[model samples]
Target: MSDLPLRSQLAVALGRTASRMSRLAGRGDGSVIGGKIGLKLDPELLTRLSADRKLVLVSATNGKTTTTRLIASAMSGLGEVATNAFGANMPTGHVSALAAAPGARYGVLECDEKYVPLVLRETGANVVLLMNLSRDQMDRAGEIWQLAGKWRKALEGVDTHVVANCDDPLVTWGASTAKRVTWVAVGQHWREDSWCCPECGGPLDREASHWACRQCPFARPKPDWILHGDRVTAPGGRTYDLDLQLPGRANRSNGAMSLAVVSLFGIAPEQALPLLGRVASVAGRYTTVQHEGRDIRLLLAKNPAGWLEAFDVLEPAPGPVALSINAQGPDGRDTSWLWDVDYRVLKGRPVWATGERRLDLAARLEAAEVDFRVVDDIEQAVMAVPPGKLDVIANYTAFQTIRTRYGRAL
Candidate 1:
């Protein structure tokens, strides 16, 4: 850091001081505030702090934080790593993460879908991981394909290597302009947002294993990494089983993507699988807490796509499930996406609705013909269920509220 400009050095110092003050004040993890201060002092602090390190940026509508964590953990065998473990995907968070670990040889930063272009331009990243794109926070992010267009323009002449999901047309089209790319066939379960061609604005020909546009040459690329049930086959036809602590097919896809990214760093899948499996929980997602003799698990689902994936990981029927929703700023000031989720799958299971927008959730559940009880308090909702395991699925702010109540703070 001594090699950096004097203004950038002072910015880093002040940012660290502000972060310490924020932690002392018990506000939160000072990632955002610290970076905000740093950027205010020196606008190019992200570029300066990111100098002389191999950087990899992970961006997606979902699973960015978990995939960043997995790639960072697997890269630990090399040396020190800098990363934002929390779900802060903006430039401020990236500045804070890089400033915090000045000596780290490698950096794995999670980037928000909208800020992908800005971060890529600033960081000049060595590798960029493009995961699935879907409709999330519609009030803020207008459409998925529009964002993909921005991504396509950003990668036009960049020298970075891209690792993209081939199953998602939006993601495939986003990485289409990159000079070098490694496609991975990570499954896409939510297909509502990507029903058409991103290139020619025509309908896509869909099949079980492949998809192509009816009006353009755009189609699914031949994948360099393919994900099967619990296994992943690499380029040379070598297969490895994914024994991960994370649950659901969604996480399996995340694992396969992480493996492909780490392989770019010359880390073999054999050496990375165990490290990926050791990650039991990310932030507060998939964490189980024992409260009053009842085991309660936390799952963060912020959109229709996220909710669809959450349902796949819930315990078997008859176990109580709690659904929580909020229209806070962090969660996007809209609840209309609730209707897109098919809650009918929970028809036979005991269901409870809680949070600031309990009525909205209750209404949606009713329309789905799934009987549910509305409980204003999360603890009360959990206690109302029989003393056993209860699963809690919530949006961004609601999940944070429960996590903080359970003594887990991000």
Candidate 2:
């Protein structure tokens, strides 16, 4: 602490104190609040704390938190890794994470899509991971293509190495301007957001896993890394099995991206794969908690793209699915995104809708011809099902509420 500037040192100390107080008061982790107070005290604290540390900034619409957790876990093999393990992905969270772990030699930060450019510029991160781009909290984030334009401008002529997903045309367009980039072919299933080219506003032609602009020269970049099913094929044709504890192909894609990022820091995939597998749950995304003698798994799906991915990880039929949604400040004050999700997939499954915005979800499910019962309370929704394993898929605040009520396991 003494090695830092006097103001930064003071900022870190005060930030830690504030975080402790917040925890003592049972108000929350204080990650954002602490960083906010610290930044107020020392405006340059993020730069000072990020200096001399090998930092990796991860940004995406859906997998930012999971990918950040995977990278941080793998980086921990080298030494202490400072990361925002929670879903605090703004500048305040970045400042709080750096301040909390001053002695850590490495930092892996989950950055919000909107704050990626600012965090990238401030941290001067060694590697910036850009995953898929989709409509998430459209009220606050505007449009996905506009966000991609901002990323393209910010990464233009940058020295940092970029690890990007090539399957999503939007991500390809965003990271194409970077000087050094390792493209990973992590498949994108959500196509509603990117039907046209971000460069020329032309219709994009999709063929299997490849996409090309019908009007412009922009196209999918040849990937240096490819994720197929549970296996990740890296450069030199070396294939590694991604035996991750985290479910679904989305997490495997996240693992592939993490492997690519850590490899730049001299961490071999063989040594890092196990570390990635150790992350069973990230910020309660895939946590299973016992409530009312019934085991319920919690999965967070905040937007259309996220819900699409979450559907892939859901348990098989007969295992009732409880869905919860909220339009809280953290979750964006908009419930119209519900219509974007195709709920017909849950037609045959036993489903229950419960949350602050359950009516909206119920209406969407009805429109899709999916039968669901609206239960006001989550526990009641779970009780409506048979005693066994139940999967609870929820948005931001609803997920937190259920996790808290059932006792946060992660």
Candidate 3:
């Protein structure tokens, strides 16, 4: 195996082998094994295989995958491009993305907050974009600040240009640690969590529709070369509307932030705004499917914040909802955080609980006095779902499996 060329060796060792193992052990767990296998391969071979040679590493609590795909799409004109487009941004997925690409110029890697520091250290990317930092997957990802510390340690002394979200104190503070960086902020109409600084526990003040913190002294002014979108007009002849097809004001901010970073990368807002409006789908993110004439919206809900955001995007749970939760060890291994979600909103509506943790989901639903059925098999739950406007909300692994099943049905 060692005698084979580096690319061939990677195929034999990582992609084919790790994919088999990933499927065998289960889907999402394979990223760690993939990462370990990749780290064992030739490191210097990457630089040797480089051409056009610009890597953009984007990481955030949310919208990382979407932005990664968007950035990859915009940057494709530069040269060969590769990314963890399917939400594989960890070590092995990182190597697999590059290895899978074979030859590429610009690498638009959509990395996770937890994996950013390590990926940055290994990839030595030219441009790094940090979207925002928030509490996500507490059972697995822990706190945002803790992950920020890991990012800081992992990013020590790596020479690169960092474009950060100045609106988020945690993200801005993280970017502040970078020696050379530019900050981007947006004026959001929605009033969400903009009070306390992730650091110093200080009160953050809002000047424009956007905000900053003077207490921690953490809130730094936007750098000279920054992009600010004080106003946003949604796609369509709706003309002067403040809504988005993807749902919620938060996504607008995420989209706007991605626009800001794209602008920083030599793409103008005027040129990219039209492209941004063209975002059709991100696998299972608020994506609706037609099953037996019923419109099913599949949303990825893992943590409290994400679940809240998903719920916000939805307008009053239409009918019975199938809340699928994956409790497999690889999918965080712990399902304790289900309590954080306000299942009461789903009360009076019929519910079908499926996935590896159906019992847990049922328990949450039951506590809210919501009517539900606990099905051991997700496919059965999906199949048993009668027609007439049913909505399907799934998490990561569950979403993939559901897609594989229904994608074939289609």
Specify the highest-lDDT model's number: 1
- Please give the lDDT score for candidate 2: 0.90
- What is each predicted model's overall lDDT from 0 to 1? 0.93, 0.90, 0.65
lDDT of 1 by residue, 1-410 (tens): 88999999999999999989999998888999999999999999998888899999999999999999999989999899999999778999999999999999899999999999999999999999999999999889888888999999999999999999999999999999999999999888999988889888899998886999999999999999999999999999999999999999999999999999999999999999999989999998999998888899999999988999999999999778999999999899989999999999998988999999999999999999998899989988988877789999999999998998886832
Clashing pairs in 2: none
lDDT of 3 by residue, 1-410 (tens): 34447664764366557866786875653544554565566554333333345788889776787778667766655566877777777766676666556667668888878877766766688878887766556677887778777766665576888877666666766777676676655432323444677668778887654556666556655443333333443223122222335566556666665655565568755666556556656755766777666567777766665676676665465576777888654467677777777877777666788887788888888887878888887655656767666666777777677766665221
Q: Give the least accurate 10-residue stretch of model 2, judged by summed lDDT.
A: 313-322
Each candidate: RMSD: 0.9, 1.0, 5.1
Q: Model 2 over residues 1-410: C-alpha lDDT tens digits?
A: 56898888888888989998998998889998899999999988898889999999999998999999999999887889999998789999999998888899899999999998898888899899999999888889998889999999999998899999999999999999999999999898899988988889999999999999999899998999999989999899999999999999889889999999999999999999999989999888898888677888899999998999899988876568999999998899989999999888897889999999999899999999988899989978888877789999999999888888887776
* Candidate order, TM-score descending: 1, 2, 3
Model 1's TM-score against the true structure: 0.99
Residue 389 in model 3: shift from native, Å?
2.5
Candidate 3 Cα outliers beyond 4 Å, as residue runs: 1-39, 43-52, 153-158, 186-198, 201-215, 223-250, 315-317, 369-371, 379-386, 408-410
C-alpha TM-scores of all predictions: 0.99, 0.98, 0.78
Candidate 1 vs candidate 2: which has greater lDDT?
1
**Candidate 1 regions with alpha-carbon error over 4 angstroms:** none
